[model samples]
Target: MTIRSSWSRAELGAFGEQVAVDHLQAAGFQIVCRNWRCRYGELDIVATDPASRTVVFVEVKTRSGDGFGGVAEAVTRDKLRRLRRLASLWLAGQDRGWAGVRIDVIGVRVGNSPAPELTHVVGVG
Candidate 1:
C-alpha cells in the first residue's frame, strides 16, 4: 500500500480553487471579494448574482481524489457558523446590505484537464 502525503493534497486543492474562481467569472458572477479573511475565518469568494440581485458568500472547496471525502465535506457546521460571522463582519465593513443574501459553494476537482469540473451549489445554507 502507498501512503499519500498531505502537502501534495493541499497543492492539488489550491489548484482546484483557482479553477473554480475562473469558472465563476466565466459564468457571469462579478467577483466582489476574494479570500476575505478575519480573525475568525475566511471567505474564499464573495460575488454578486446579477439575476437575483443578491450578495453571494461563496465557499470554495477543492479535491484531488474522493478517497477521504468530497470537497463539500470540508464545510462543517462550525465552519458554516464561522463563515456566517465573517460574512457579517464583511458586510458591516462594506456598510452595505442588499435585499438578498445567499450562501454558495463552489466545488472543484483538479486533474490533467485544462478546465476543471466545477459544481456550484447555490443557497446551500
Candidate 2:
C-alpha cells in the first residue's frame, strides 16, 4: 500500500529532516542541532560521530518528486563551498574543540510510500 502526504513544501522538508535525524541517530550520530543558521546560510543538521569524534555538518535536500533530478543533484560546487564556510563559522562560535570536521549531504525522496528514500553521502566536502 502507498501512503499519501498532504504536507506543504516546507512541511515536507521538515519531515525529511526529521527522518534524516532519526536515521542518523540510529547510525550512532549524536545530533547537536537542527536548522542552524547564520548570515551566510543554514546547516540542516549538525551531528557528532562518537567513534570518529568528528563534527558533521549536513546539508539536506528533500524532494517530493524526481522530475528535476535526484535530490543530491541540487548540491552544487558552490553550495559545497557555502557549506564549508558555514562550517567554519559554526566552529568559530564553539567554545570547545572538535576532533575534526566533515561535511555530509542527505538526500530525501518523499513519495507515496510512508518510508521516504534516503541517501547519505558522507564527507562530500
Candidate 3:
C-alpha cells in the first residue's frame, strides 16, 4: 500500500475531520455529513440521533493547544450565525422533520504529548 504524504494544512484538517468522526460516533451521534459547505462557510460535522430525532450541527476545531487560543474560542458569534444559515440550508434539502435541532462544538487537540481529547459542547445558541 502506498502512503500519502501529510504535509499540508488542508490535509491535517481532513485528518482531524476523520478523528472527529470517530469521536462523534463513539459518543452516539450518527454521521449525516462531513465537510458540508456553502458559500458562507463549512460545517465540520452534521449528525442525527434516531432516539431523540435531534439534528446536531457540529463544528470541529483542531488546535495544537491553547498557545494562540482554544478551539472553542475560535467560534465567534458571526461564525455561529453562518453555521446556522448553512444548517438551515441543509435541513431545507432534507425531509427528516426532526423533533429538535442543536448546535454543538467539538474541539480536538491532537499531538504527541497525549491522546486526542474531544470536548463536546452542546446547545450553543
Q: Name every residue pair that clashes in candidate 1.
A: none
True-vs-predicted CA distance for residue 37, candidate 3, Å: 1.7
lDDT of all predictions: 0.75, 0.87, 0.79
**lDDT (tens digit, per residue) of candidate 3 on 1-125:** 11134336676567667777898788787999888888877888999877898999988887655775776687899999988899999989896699999998877766635466667788886
Which has the greatest TM-score? 2
Off by over 4 Å in 2: 1-3
Report the C-alpha displacement of residue 102, candidate 3, in angstroms: 0.7
TM-score of each: 0.81, 0.92, 0.86
Give the Å shift of residue 41 in candidate 1. 1.5
Instruction: Sort all candidates by TM-score, best to worst.
Output: 2, 3, 1
Q: Pick the candidate with the highest lDDT.
A: 2
lDDT of 3 at 72: 62
Q: In terms of lDDT, which candidate is stronger, 1 or 3?
A: 3
User: Number of clashing pairs, model 1?
Assistant: 0
- Measured on C-alpha atoms, candidate 3 has an lDDT of 0.79
Order the candidate numbers by lDDT, best to worst: 2, 3, 1
Candidate 2 clash pair list: none
